[model samples]
Each structure stands twice: as structure tokens, then as C-alpha cells.
Target: MSLKYIDLFAGAGGLSEGFIRAGFEPIAHVEMNGDACDTLKTRTAFHYLNEKNQIEEYYNYLKGKITRNELWAKIPDNLINAVINTEISAETLPTIFEKIDSVLGKDKVDLVIGGPPCQAYSVAGRARDPKGMTEDPRNHLYKYYVEFLKRYKPKMFVFENVPGILSANNGGYLELIFEAVKEAGYELDKKVLNAKHFDVLQDRKRVIIIGWKKNLKLKYPHFEENEPQYEILKDLFSDLPKIKNGQGEWGAVDYAKETNNYLEKSGIRNGVCFTSQHIARPNNPNDLEIYKIAVNKWVQDNKRLNYAELPERLIKHNNTKSFTNRFQVVNHKGISHTVVAHICADGHYYIHPDIKQNRSITVREAARIQSFPDDYFFEKSRTTAFKQIGNAVPVLMAEGIANKIKEMIK
Candidate 1:
């Protein structure tokens, strides 16, 4: 039997997707964003359809070969039953818990996995609103997570967050988090892991807190010495079709005829591809020149050009030393810096490696680096899509953790 799990604060279902890939059945996904909720439903519907051996029907819909109604007609009933679009809080917690109980009575949930909004504990968020972060109600959102753990009493639970949590509120938040997990009767183990170590193409670090009943005596999974090597942007993205600045491609974009190991493992099979969401934003002339210089310096000159090194024509400010490395050039052959939610604001920190592109990385390329499979679609506007991708846990990194959890449980 597949282990059952529920995802809370499930933005675009990244963690849930990885867990599901590791053989866990998703009971439900709880998220507050309307676009993300729609994505959840669509993805869940696709999964249910796939489970019923009807993925071809869904794929046909994605390729525009069938009507939306026709696609839904093939989706299993369980699809609609699995996504809950609501905010979890003290006020709505009881009703939500009651419904979960009703739907899953006597069926024990094996795990509960989620990361509450991390803005209150994220470095960028703290930098942006030094005082507002501490005062933000989101700081205590984990209490709702704790409440679920207390009520569900799942065999195990996974709490993920930005590394800023380690020092948020002078580390008091971390202490309280551990205390809450302990009070709920679970032994907890935590470590800060870099996604690069798990074959994710970005140098993203996240703190994962795994908790389980004391009686189970489960040990956290150790990093495998033989795990896949760190991936570079070129390895993950070179197969994707290129889009120029301000270019957007709907429907299907063609993939290279040749398949690489990463592409194959990521579910991008060798065939005519129907990838979506590969939209690139138009860079202003000023930013475009900056991107060109950055990419040229990184690729041709073998250096990262700082603001001070730029020609006076491209220099916009007097204080060049402060934000020297503001325009980051991604080395195609090297792993990327962390992809963050701020990417939605401006792509200055994530310029595409190819100088000819003259723009920041596209939504699809960002998703690729984050280990989201080509088939996994991000619904809504470019802003929402980028935010969802940037904020997501690298799916493969989550998968590695999920696999270890499954092994211990089994």
C-alpha cells in the first residue's frame, strides 16, 4: 500500500510532487493562492488520470488536440477531491481537520509535509522589511502546522524552511519550533542541505526538519557519497528551445532530438515535446545592455563584471562598489546561485548565459534549474509562475529526502 500524505501551505505542490514521485499518495493539498490552487487541481487531475491509465487523454488536452471539457471527462473523480483552496488558521483549522477526518477516517496519514510561508524568516524578506517581518503574523503560522501535527499524529512529518530560520529573532524562532515538535511527542532531526548535492542545478540551501514518533527510532537519511554530481545550467537547460528577449511560446516547443541523462531522468522523453510556460520578459534597452555585458564577461572574458567595471554609459549610480555584483552572470557550465522569489521583481541576478539572448532566464529555464519536469506546468501570469518556481523546493532534492523517509518507514 502506498503511504498517504497531506501537503499544507502547498505552493504549487512542489514538495507534494516529489513525495508523490517517491510512492506516497497525496490525500490533499492546502494552498491559499488562486492560481496555485488551479495548478494543484490540474496537476492532481493529471495524476489521477495517469493512475487510471488515461494520461494520453490528458496529454492530448495539453497538446491542444482535445477540448477542455473532453479532458475533464477523462479525469478520474478523485482529482477534484484532492485539492483544498483555503488558508489554514486558528479560525478555519477545525473545519478543515474535521473534513480530513471525515474523508480519511481510520486511514492513518503516514506523513504531513510543508513549509509555512518563509517570508518572516527569509533573508531577503527580512532585509526588505526589517521590523515588519518580526511583526508579520506569518511568523507564527507554524503554530497552525503544529496544530495539525498534534491532531493528525502522523507517523512522520517534514518541515522545510529557508536557512534564515536558524537566526530569525535571534534564533528564538528555531527554539520554539523545536519545542513545539517535541511537545507533540516526536523526536526531531534537522540539517541544512544544499540542492546541488542532490543533483539540483542550483546552489540553493534549505533547512529540513524531519520529525517522527520516538518509538519508531527513525534516523535521518545520510547524504550518499555516490549521489549524482552537481548539475550545471547548460546540462539542465541546453536541451530547451531558445527564446529571444521578450519572446513567448505557447503550446508545444520542440526539444532536441538527442536526450541527456538529466533530461531523461526529469521526464523529458525523446520525442516531439509539448512544453509550455517558456515565456521570457522583454528587457529594457538599459538592462539589455547590462545583461549583454554581464554574459559576455562571464562567457568570453571568464569574469563576472561588476557595476564599477561597466562603461560609464551603462553605469546608473555613483556607488558602484556597494552593489558591485548586482548583475550576476550565470555560467552555463557551472551551477547557478540560488533562485529566489525576488527573481519575479527583476532578473538582474539571474541573467541568461547566452549573450545573444540579452535577457534574464525565462520561466521555463528557471523551472528546469529547480528540477521541475517539463511536463509540470505552472499556471497563470509570468509573475506568478516565476514566483511559484523560485519559491519551490527543488523537486529532486525533495525526492531524495522522500525516498529516505519511505525506506525508514517501510
Candidate 2:
């Protein structure tokens, strides 16, 4: 028997993907974004394709060698229905519950996993709109999460979010969350975890809260006491084929055929030829020159650049001194800075180290930095792809937590 779980606020299924890779059976996933839901459906379908030896056909479709209809013709019909995409809301909760009940029947869920939208509790968001954030309905989204826990009473639950959550609403929000979970008869343990401390190549930090049913008497998970061998950018992406700024898409018929240790170690399945989402955006001439200057300064200034020191021509705006560390040339020798949704706006905060590249990092590079497997595809437009990747918890980080949960259960 396999452990069964449900995911809520499941953006592009990143957390769910990690659990799946850890050998759990995902019972259902709920997200409100249509584009992200589409991504979830296709990725779920791909898993089925893997099981049925139909991945080759899908790859052929990606290669543009076959019509969409031809690709569908060869895939199993059931594989197409592998995971149902439920766009959730207040009114739709009952219907979603009914579907979950019908699917699982009498089998109890082993775990419940998700993080409610965190913008209301993020430090950057609070800084941007301190007044508006206080009244934001998103601040209380955790209530819905608690409601699900009350209904299902899973053996364990994993909640993920930004560390800012600790002090959100001057500590009121965190208190409310703990009070609700305690009332529901669960013991909670949480900590702020850095991705670079767990084999990921980015300096991303997030708070993971784990709850076990009070009767279980399970030991809470502790951070790995030993120092982690943090991966630099090269460890994660040096094997990928290089691309110039504004480079058009380039994927071969059988991509992933030649992969590096990062891909293989990350468990990315082979046979992929061309990279997905590797296309770069055209850089503005001024920004292009700034990238060159930034990378050079980054290397010369001991891997750091001060925005105030740049020449006026390279400075995009006046009075920019306050935005110290505004233009960062990511150190290739060190772990990357955190990837965030702001990357969707522009890569100014995350420029490539190589001046020759002369542009912000591409979606694929961002995904790799987040520890997503090379073969893992981000769907919809490039903007949407960037947003999903930016907002995702690193797959490796999530997997490490899930594996610990699995051990506690056993």
C-alpha cells in the first residue's frame, strides 16, 4: 500500500512533484490559476506516459515531428486522466471534497500537504503595501487549510511558507495558525530551512511546518546536523548547452540524450534532446551594456557590485544609491541568490555571471537553480513559466523533507 496525500494551493504542483518523486501517491491537487492547472494536468499525464513507455511519442510531439492528434492517438486514454485539475474556491469546496471522497472511498489519507498563498505574509510584500496587506483576504487563507485538516484528520501534514510568516501581523497571524492546529489535536514543529543547506544550489529560505496527529508520538524532524555540500550554479547547469541573448528555442528530436551528472543525479529521465524554456529574451541595449559592466565588476570587486559606484551611463536612473546591490551578477562559484516572482518582471536581480551571455537568466536556468530536473517542463508562456518557477519551493528541498516524513511514519 502506498501513502496517499492531497495538495492545496498547489502552484504548478512543485511540492506535489517532490512528494511524487519520494514515492507517495498524490490523490488530488487544487489550484486557482488556470495556466498552472494546465501545467499540472500535462505533467501528471507525463508521469503516466512514463509508466506506459509512451514518453518517446510525447518527446516526438515536443520535437514537432508529429501532429498533436498523432501524439494523443498513441497515449493511453487513462493516462490522460491521471490527475484531475481542480480550480478551487469557497463555493467549490464541497464539490472538491465530494470528488476526493469518491476517489478515496474508505481509504484514509496518510498526509495533507500545501502552503496557502504567502504574499500577505512576505516581508517584501509587507514593505510594498503595509496598509493594504493588513486587510488582504489572503492573510487568512490559512483558515481554509485548517478546515481541510479538520475534515480529513490526516496522520501528518506539511505546511510550507515564507519565514516572514513568523512575524506577520506583528505575530498575530502565526498565533492564530498555531491555535487552530492545536485545537484540531495535532502537534506542530516548524523551522526556517535554507535550500543551499540541503543540496540545492540557491540561497532560498522557507519555513516548513510539520504536524503529526497527537496520538502518533512521532519524533519531530530536525535539521541535518552535518554541514551540507552546497552546489554552485555550475553543478546544477554547466552541462546545459549555451545560448546567446535573444536566442530562439533550440530542441532536438531526442533531447536529454546527452546529460551531465546534475541531470542524472537529479533523476531526470533520459532521451530528451532539446531543452524546454531555454529561450532568452532580447536585452535592451542599455541593459545589455550594464550586464557586461555588472559581471566585470562582480568578478573584479570580489563577487559583489555596488549600484552607487556605476558610471551614470550604466545607471538606469538617478537617485539609485538607495537600491544598493540592485544589479547582482550571480557568483558562478557560489550558490545563487534566491529566485523570486520578480524575475518575471526582469532578470536584473539575477544576471548571468558570464558577460558574454549579456542577459538575465532564462526560465530554464532559473528552474535549474531551483533544483528542478532538466527534463521537468514548465508549461504555458515564458512569463507564466517564469512565475511558476519563481514561486515554487525547490524540488530537492521539498523531497528532503518528504523523505523525513516518510521515515517518521514508518
Candidate 3:
């Protein structure tokens, strides 16, 4: 039988997707955003029907041929009901537990995976906040995670967060986390992991904490570095049709060129001829001009554009002293910088390396950089899609972790 697990604070199912690919069955996904919840359900439907060779039904939905309601009707009730949409808080814990209990129904939870939202623990977020996010209530959300571990008594768990988490609260919160987990009867180990090491194209990093039952004989899995088959611009982006600002659509877009060996080996250009969310965000005249300069600077000198060095006419912000190097072009020649949640607010930091396009990266490009497959759709508004993509753990990286986990558990 496949091992069962629960995902907490599941963002667009990135981590869960990895676990699922590694052969674990997801019993439940607990999240607060209703839109992300919809995405989780859609993906669940895809997995269930795809196993039954009904992927055409999903392709139909993505092609705009069928409504979401129609797609859900074909999926089983149990799979559709696994996603629980609500906040995990003190007031809501009881109800969440009751719902999980109903769904669990004698199934032993072999694992619990997920991390609380990282805003309070993010360095960028703290820099923008007045109190440095020390006063943010999210600092204590780990308490709720501990509550789940105690309740389920999973043999193992994976907790993920940003590097800032190690220093947040001067290490007070992490101390609390260790204490809480120990009190709940689990031994834990932690390390900083990079997605590039896991065959992901982006150089994203996260703090991964692994825990197991106190008496269990388990060790933190050793991960090895993996190299991708092609460059970011040449292989990852060449197949997608290019468009200018405010161009492209969420529906299907035909492949711009024939798939190469690198693309196939990377599992990026999967047999699908079309994908969704290739659309770019609309850009204002000033932003467009700046984007042109940013892309040109990269194409010529391979240097980042400084906000303070922009033409006088294109200048907008009064205080250029801070965030001077905000307009950064993605390093198309190699691994790109971290894909952060802030991209949803503005794409200035994520200017596409292609000068002809003359805009920020598209939703599909961002998703691809994060190692999400082309067919994995992010539901709801485009901005929200960006947010979900930005916040998610890279599926490629998570799969590597999951594979090791499967081996260890077995």
C-alpha cells in the first residue's frame, strides 16, 4: 500500500506534487487561500482522471472547451473533497481536526509535510515592515504545525522555510520549534538546500527541516548536485511563442519551434503542443521603456540596470537611494535568481532577458524557471497565479527530497 501523508499550508500543491510523484498518497491539503484551494482540487482531479487515462478531459478544460464545473464532475468525490480550504488558527483548529479526522478514517499518517507562510520570517518582508515583522502574528504559526504532528503522530515530517527563518526572532522561534517537536516526541535535523542542486534551473534556496519519531532509525537524506541539460534562455524559453506587453493569453498557445533533445530530457516540453498562462502582465509606458533598457543592458554588457542610473524622463520614485539595482534581468545563460513572492507586485526585478519582447517575464516563464511542468495550471487571476508560483516550493527539488524519503521509510 502507498504511504499516506498530509500537507499543511500547501501552496498551489508544489510540495504535494513532488510527494505524489515519489509515490505517496496525499490524504489532505490544508490551505487558507480559496483560489489555491481550487488549484489543488483541479490538480487532484487531473491525477485521478489521468491515472484512468482521462487526461483528455483535463486538456479539454485547459483548452477552454469545458468549464471547471464540468471537469470536477468526472473526478471522484473522495479526491475532490481532500482539499480543505480554511485558515489553520487557534479558533479553527478544532473544526480542521474534525474534518481531517473524517477524511483520515483509520488511515495511518506516515508523513506530514509543509511549512507556515514565510512573510514574518522573510528578510525582504522584514525590511519593508515598520517593526521588522517582529510583531507579525505569523511568527507563531509553527505552533499550529506542531499541533498537527502531535495529533497525527506521523513517523516523519518535512518542514520548509526561507533562510531568514534561522535568524528570525534571534533564533527564539526556531528554539521554540525544536522544543515543541521534542515535546511532541520527534527528533529533528535541518539544513539549507538549494534547488539548483536538485536539477532545478533556478538557484532558489530554502531551509529544510526533517524529523522522525524519537526511537526511529532514520538519518537526514544526503542529496547530490544535478546539472540541467541546457541553458535557461536557449532550452527553457526557445519553444514558447514570444509576445509584447499585454500580449498572449491564458488559453492554448502553439509551440513556437520543434522540441530539442535538451527540452525533452528536462521533461519540460512534455508531449503537449500547447500550455496555459503564457500571458505577460500589462506594462505602462515608463515601465516599458525601463524594461527595454534593462533587457538591452543585459544583452550588451551583461550588467544589471540601476534605478538611479535610468534616464531622467523615466525616473519615477523619489528615493532612488534604496533598491537602486531593482531592475535585474534573468541570467538566461545560467541558473536564475530566486523567484520570490514579491514578483506578483511588480515584475521589475524579473525583466525578461529578451529585448524584443520588452517586458517582464510571463507567468509561464516564471513557472518554468521554478521547474513546474508546462501543464500544471495555476488557477484564478494572473496576479494570484504569479503569487502562487512565487510562493511554491520547486517541484523538481521537492521530488528529490521525496524520493529519498520513500527509500528511508521503506
Off by over 4 Å in 1: 65-78, 225-233, 268-272, 316-321
Give per-candidate clash totals: 0, 7, 0
Which digits, one per residue and each the tens of the lDDT, describe model 3 over residues 280-379? 9899999989988988888888888889999899999998999898889998898789999889999999988888898889999999888888888889
Instruction: Point out the higher-scoring one by TM-score: 2 or 3.
Output: 3
Candidate 3, residue 330: how far the Cα is off, in Å: 0.8
Task: State model 2's lDDT.
Answer: 0.77
**Best-to-worst ranking by TM-score:** 3, 1, 2
The TM-score obtained by model 2 is 0.92
Per TM-score, the best of the predicted structures is 3
Best by lDDT: 3
RMSD, candidate 1, Å:
2.2
Local lDDT at 95 for model 1: 79
Weakest ten-residue segment in model 3 by summed lDDT: 260-269
Candidate 2 lDDT by residue in tens digits, 1-410: 88989888888877888898888887778787777776776676667678787787666655668754565455554433334555456777798788778767788889999998889999888988949489888888888888788989999999999999998888899889999998998999888889876677778889999999999997569868334443454465565556668874634422423566656676542545565667777788888887888888777776577777777777767767577787887777777889888888888888888776677888878888887765666766788888998989888888888898888887
Candidate 3 accuracy as TM-score: 0.97
> Per-residue lDDT tens digits of candidate 1, residues 1-410?
89998899999888888999899998778888888887787787678777888777767766778865666566555456567778998888987887677667678899999999899998778888958488989999888999988888899999999999998999889899889888989999889988877787778889999999989988787876334454555467766677788896755566644668877766544243567777788888988988888888888888987889888988887887787988997768778889988888888988988776678888888888888877777776788888988888888888989999998888
